[model samples]
Target: MKLVVRRSVCFQGHQIPDQEAACQQSYGPDLEYRDLMRVTAIVICAALAGCQAVPGEGPLASAINEDAGRSPAEIGRVNAAVFDIVDVDNHTARLVSDYVSTALKRRFGIGGGPGRAVIGIGDQLKVTIFEAGADGLFSTNDSKQATIDVVVQPDGTAAIPYVGTVRFAGRTLEQARQEILASLKSKAVEPDVIIGMGDTPSRSVTVAGAVNRSAQIPLNLSGEQITDVIAKAGGPTSQPYESYVTLVRGKKTGTALLKSIVENPSENIYVQPGDQIFVTRDPRTFTLLGAVKSNSRIEFGANDLNLLEAVALGRGGNDETVNAKGYFLFRYEDPEVVLGLLGQRRFDELARKGMQPDKDGRYPIVYRFDMSHADSLLVGQTFPVKSRDVIYASRHPAVDLTKFLRVIGAPVGIAVQGAAISNNLSD
Candidate 1:
């Protein structure tokens, strides 16, 4: 039988202040307090083995630097949008109901298929009284005046005069008319009752949590596919959709993948009645603050992001102006802690590949890849990206912030003194 041990160390490569480094070194590597380097060596060895000899994706499970081959990247950049959530408390519902009503009017008779289906307690129904003649059963009143209120009965069915106690609560108008005809055949001699639904019913699906537009998606049975529902409520606003659309059906919640459903036809599932679709945004993003083209938070694609891809999103590096050699990554120091929760096989492979820090402190626990390697097409394909890794491209040594401030400060001071003297003379 083999035994396994776990370890962690917080490594910061930025050379400490002279005062702190001298103080820490004087404490000596003896007392238990000096655990940073002692513990780091074990993780360093794990990380080295990973960089040099690891084969396959299994070993470097949490190594964010691994490449995903050439297939996914070639797809190029598509729409990188995010969704926001909306609640159906009371006031918003009315606005949605009115909008859906207009949409239904335009959609009528355009498609041979059934019109949109909507659900709400107070939807209206168009009931026309037609007297049979040799020609046809013409409407007694204008189609406008014949519209009637759909009332709920004690038994749950809606009430109508000629078609008393017709069951229309849960059923669509089409389904309700079929039930009404079945009831009338038993009483009148071959009665002719024509029914049509007025306006799209005002039913809603609640969109809650981290999306861009989280509002109720007005439903019509005519509408199908999860995308149709998302489109109805405004699509995601950010790049590369993160999180997922969750369908909450009572106590049971099921997940609908955003990419697979959008990219693949087989995965698109239909929205059911009383279903709540929620889109959640991801908090895991690379924070690139200094000396970059677009200094903003870049949220990585959930599955396919590596070191090179992260830089590419920021329009790559402007090495001609800034120093590319100073580029580095910052993340939670202990990669093993996060890997352990992912899978056991993954953890062992990461350890064996030296992706975990070495038992003898040398390089960082994480790999430091050179962006220059991307010049070669083969090497670029070999690199992979992981979620939440922060990439920072440091300023060139020749250009220093401290020096720039000192050079500018003298001129501004001289100008200020001259202005003060001139102002005193004017006064």
Candidate 2:
């Protein structure tokens, strides 16, 4: 006795209609429903497992997954000073001003003059004596004049005829002339003297490194500036923006960009004797990574390199896969500056915990630029990219979703095929 059966299925709450006309060989209706439900449940479970296994798979899987556990706010709270690009640029301008002011003060002091030029031993002097009388000691005829070449002695005196050994070292040219005139007043009748520097051997500034010609430039009464000495050495061989000019005067030393020294009058302080001016090609550079068209180290070509220019240097802005809102620039900034930028309450909380910068006097700082906003273009224009900075553009959400879907497609396909095969066999 053959039992007539109809093929019907119920999945979750939805029922499939029965083929009543077909009285096929029986796979018991209750058993078939149980089997279908079991297959459906297995497929759903497999799909869920596949999703769980591939959670980290995506186009941005490598980049975003690394920090998946930390949200933006949580990451910011962990001792990393975060700011918008616009605020960062404004603060950086203040920082540059402070640096310039400090550099000027260090090199030039309160007054911008080069100060007095003191005579020293080993310096040559051209001394001219004039006599009013025809029969005077220095007179050969009616034009009564005598010239003598003198070198400052180690004991700070210069030997002269009838004037004995006079102390002239450590005195200016005018002072030396007065001393010589007083000494000769007792010897020659109505003697007058004029002292001028012939070749200054002891007072010189050394210009070295990256200049076309490195030399020891003499410091004269003209009070030549740093730029003047550098120019005498044939100027800098490297690009001004890429070069750094360091001034070492006695125990004090200061460094600034060559471009800054050229553009800012205060920075072109007078060069003092014994000052060492070094111009080096210490080019500032930043790293471009993540969703940029090209990832590499980019040197700053200008004195002020804004975010837009930096992005362009890295082979144009971010690619299609980038998240416009997730552009980031990482740097090390002064701790005090970071705190000042954060303002009162947040700074107080962080300071209370004794959060200090490292030995380099820098704290880790991160700046976000939301390219999604139209005003961000202007912000990018003003935002400066400092040396050793890292510019990163994060991947878009769609990239992750597409990657996940691609990763799970095979498993899901297999599950669907299995369900279809089970249905066919049951039918």
Candidate 3:
């Protein structure tokens, strides 16, 4: 049986006539037909969706999916820190929406209607006329960009033309308009005023740090967020891999992680005037131990240090006699962070067994060594050092003690002998 279709009229002056209305009114009778129709519609929607490309499935997918490729140098890392156009998509949408809303309110003369009283500032005003055609404050240029300077008196009223001095600063535009029109009945035939933003520069936020650039981002009716501020400053520099950013608002400061704050819309706090955003750099650090002039920490601007380079940085052993021997390198790098040149099989075996080598491997090895040997120098060159590595060097006990006696005891012996001879001559 063919389904009788009728349309019905819903709210807001929309018409749903005969066929549609009849179906709704008799849904009990048309239940099977309606069910079929709903199923058909869902199927059609699914078919359409199947035909369409999914997000990140098309040509642009490659670009979007590509991780900020491995940065080999500090310069490359810094370049990667720039925020892409896609990152600011939400900010763009919000700004457009807010600006459109502001424009609509202004165009429709919707001066915050009654019960929603607007606010006003010093020299601020709201001019309106119940009788119409009596709005006359500045009409010469008729330009919306009118500039008439007036002080907000101690009584909270501003001195204006025709109406003399009237309190308006703290009141909403509508409130000020009504109050002024009431007071102007004796002076002029009509009175109305419109309050607006002043010519003074609005409040802005400043972003600074390991960013490509830094600037003060302005605020319109459409506000911005921390991410927007970071983008404005050219994003965070990858050299430091800013795990989190810090924002200073007056005396108080808050820290936000890049991932958490960006992904969660609720936490994306609206930036305020005078807010300072600092994008931090990755804490650069390298480790040093073993036989070196300075067995301490070394820092880098970038994430890099060669095994030999780090040892050299540590002055590579103290006295000429104590050269680095059987150099041992300890690294805190990821277990999977592979080194291209290093023998992977050997390295992995050593890593898995937690076995470190000594000078001799035939029998129970005596791992300690004297730096005076020439072979130790070559060992120092090959042993690789990594981030946060500890280079431990076992010194030969005999060599250390002998060098110490030469360095200290001999000098004291000569001084004592000379003193005794002088005493004998004096006697």
Candidate 4:
């Protein structure tokens, strides 16, 4: 009472070899192919059930599952509160006109150099007195030359031979010479004085950090600038494009890109006495992740970098896997900017929850760009990329589907092949 049966199974369009053909030819009526068909159906059903058990668990699925509880409308509501959806054109113009233009107008005033250099405390002076007589009070024998080295004291005066103390601090070289001549006039007949600077410790700017040489450059009557100080310090250790200069004058401080300081005259402000200039290799960088060609930190070579340029640097979004509509930039934006984007009511709500802006008055922001349209290419050209930004391009639905199919198809194909081989071996 032996029964014969035939079964056909396919996994992802790959047909399983016919086990019944060999079984029927070798075992005749003794072999029951119905059992083999039953086993094949059970294995495939188990595989499909396993896949169905974890539906929507592909790469992109899992990646987006974190926010799956929220619907699209709800997600839009949440994003509207914390995110800014701007077209490329509007953001591009806003960045250039608002951020860059404003920064260029901020220039520190530098004093014009007077005819005579002013004297200050801690300055070393070389005084030479010339007498009209053969042997004056400052002269010995027939020599009229009397050279004296005196450092300007804290009291702003310098000691002179028989001339008492002369106040030289805050006085120009010509003014100090006149004061010295007036003092020596009573003691000697027609005494002429020449005062020269031996050391100029007070009139210098300190340059430090990321330079070939850290030094204190003297500020002369020519009026040195920020660039001049950096040059005197042997320039920056890093590339100018990849470096920044910080100028600290007294209590006030300002920072600009080294390349900008070199190219833009306004950013190359005058370097004053006691000003500290630090050249640092702290280039503005953004982190690229997800479906980008390269997922790493990308440094900006210049002062301005738009979204298109940033994406190009990351090798453009992965064409095969990226979701064109889901490109995002994560950043902390100024509260005022966020207010302008999200409106005052939503901002106030977030503020009430103790989500205060940072020291820079900026709140957490996420910027989404839809690259699905051709016009978005123009928008990406003008949208600026700020420092510490995170750029991400989500995966496409097809990529997730392909991944899901692979997960299920592999085991089913293996089971079909194994069942066919076992049936052949048994026969």
Tens digits of per-residue lDDT for model 1, 1-427: 1112221212243332324223222234454523534433333333232222322212121122232111223324232111111212233223322221111112121224333463345556675543333332333343312345564444556776656776656676667767766765554444456666554334556666655677776566565666777776677554334656677766766554465457554445556555687776553477663456766678765555555667778887655334443455544432333233324574454444333343321112233334444443333334444345566664432223122212322222222223323222222
By lDDT rank, best first, the candidates go: 2, 4, 1, 3
Superposed on all Cα atoms, model 3 deviates from the true structure by an RMSD in Å of: 36.9
Whole-model Cα lDDT of every candidate shown, in order: 0.45, 0.67, 0.43, 0.67
TM for candidate 3 is 0.32
231 Cα displacement, candidate 2 (Å): 0.9
Which regions in candidate 2 have their CA more than 4 angstroms from the true location?
1-111, 316-320, 334-340, 344-363, 397-427
* Model number with the top TM-score: 2
State every prediction's TM-score relative to the real structure: 0.41, 0.70, 0.32, 0.63
Clash tally for model 3? 29
Q: For candidate 4, what is the lDDT?
A: 0.67
- Per-residue lDDT of candidate 3, residues 9-33 (tens digit): 2324444343533443224544574
Off by over 4 Å in 1: 1-123, 133-147, 152-155, 170-172, 186-190, 199-203, 208-214, 240-244, 254-260, 280-304, 311-386, 389-427
| Residue 350 Cα positional deviation in candidate 4, in Å, after optimal superposition | 7.5
Better of 1 and 2 by lDDT: 2
lDDT of 4 by residue, 1-427 (tens): 3323333345455554546653232334554667546544554443343333344422342234333223335555533333334333465436533643213225354434323457888989899999888768887666887889989999999889798889988898889899889988989867999988877887888999999999989878666877888899998888877787888877777777787778766666666667898888987899888887888899887767988899899898788777776677767775556666667886676565445455555676666677878978777776778778888786654443334335544333334434433223222
